[model samples]
Target chain A: MSIALYFFAGLSAAAALGVLLFRQVLYAALSLLACLLSLAGLYIVMQAEYIAVTQIIIYAGGILVIILFGIMITSRLAGKPMQVSTQYPVIGSLLALLIFCALVLSQPAVTSHTSDFSTNHWQRAGRWLMTEYALAFETTGVLLLICLIGAAVTAIYQRES
Target chain B: MSPVLLYLSFLLFALGVSVVLTKRNAIVVLLGIELILSAAILNAIHFNQQFPDRMDGQLFALFIIVIAVCEAVVGMSIIIRVYRYYQTAVPDQINELNER
Candidate 1:
């Protein structure tokens, strides 16, 4: 488990860097896919099976398709492949390095815990969502509905005008 | 809360920051934001494991995923709109909002 965790973590980190450094938008999108998949692996290693499945479904399936559509639409409209220009590369790298150092320095000490991987993690999570987090769950549903309508309206309105 | 996980989260977050700061393409910036959100989700799940009796972190991470999907949809729509109006998706080249 530890070995798999570290391997996924390293893969995720590398893919994230690829997203940052890749020149073409499509390349970055592919890199983002790799990063998200690796993150799902990390979630599994952390024993969060429900979260892992959700990550793969929403991020890799839903969000990535949306992003790819966005890329396709823009590239079609522009009649060329999408390539982003870099701005303040040196300064951005320096700032990122500085923040990373701060984060590393502030990490909490690891505490040992007895391994107890719950097989019914999704069941427990669903119960919590329906009970303790019921209000938030309902709110998220409303929020998603509103966002869906708003996005559709915005896209249509933009195309018209 | 292994040290390796902590370091990995930091590394991913840093890469997200650099992507957001340096990339001119709006879609790529959205990708960077996704990376940052993933890192945050990882931290939440890690701590929740430390207190396994309560699954608050897992639930929170689930809600976050929902919100992130919404965010991506809305953000991409707006970016497409901007690309249509400005004829460019590069943030530096879009100055209509700044134009008086």
Candidate 2:
């Protein structure tokens, strides 16, 4: 588990760096895919198989595809494969380094307790959703519908008079 | 709760912030936002591992994923609209609101 955790963690960090350094928008998107997938693997190592699966399905599967489509369409509109440039690259990288250092230095020592009994995460999550979080669940559905409608309206190309 | 995973998320967050700060492309900026959201989700998952009995962290992570999905969709749509109007993808170049 430790080995897998370190591997995924390293992969995710590397991919995130690629997202920052890559000049091609396509390459950056691909880096994001790698980062997200590795993070999902880390989730599995943490013994949260349900969240891992959800991460893979929803994030890697759904969101990544949508992003790729957007990239493709936008590039087509520009009549060239999309490329990227940077502004204040040095300052931005330095700021990020400072932020990371701050996070590491300011964190308090952590203590974790392992549970003796293993629970069925899927069943338990479903039960909680249907019972304690029923209202939130329904509200989420409504929110998604609203987002779909809002996005469609915003993106629709209407000739502005 | 796990320090390793927590550190990893922190690293992701910092890198994401840099991408947003430096990148000129709106799409890349959107990707940076995704990275930031991912870091937040990782934090929730790490906390879930810490307290296995209380599934609040897991539940919050799930809901956060939904919110991120919405954000990405809307964000991309807005970027597309902006590109159409400005004929460029860089956020810095969109200066219609700026006094000439």
Write model 2 residue lDDT over A57-125, tens digit each, in one string: 998999889889888877745666688999998999999999999999997666666554466778888
- How does the DockQ of candidate 2 come out? 0.73
lDDT values for all models: 0.87, 0.87
Best by lDDT: 2
Q: How many pairs of residues collide in each model?
A: 0, 0
Backbone clashes in model 2: 0
First chain of model 1: TM-score? 0.91
Tell me how far the alpha carbon of residue A78 in candidate 1 is from the true structure, in angstroms, after superposition.
7.1
lDDT, candidate 2, B1-100, per-residue tens:
3688879889999999999999988889989999999999888878776677877787888899899999999998998898788776678888988999
Q: Write the per-residue lDDT of candidate 1 for residues A90-150, one digit (tens) a residue.
A: 9999999999999988888866353476457778888888999999999998999999999
Model 1 stretches with alpha carbons more than 4 Å out: A76-80, A112-114, A157-161, B97-100
Candidate 2 displacement at residue A37 in angstroms: 0.6
Q: Per-residue lDDT for B36 in model 2? A: 96
Docking category for candidate 2?
Answer: medium
* Model 2: per-residue Cα lDDT at residue A12: 97
Q: Clashes in model 2: which pairs?
A: none
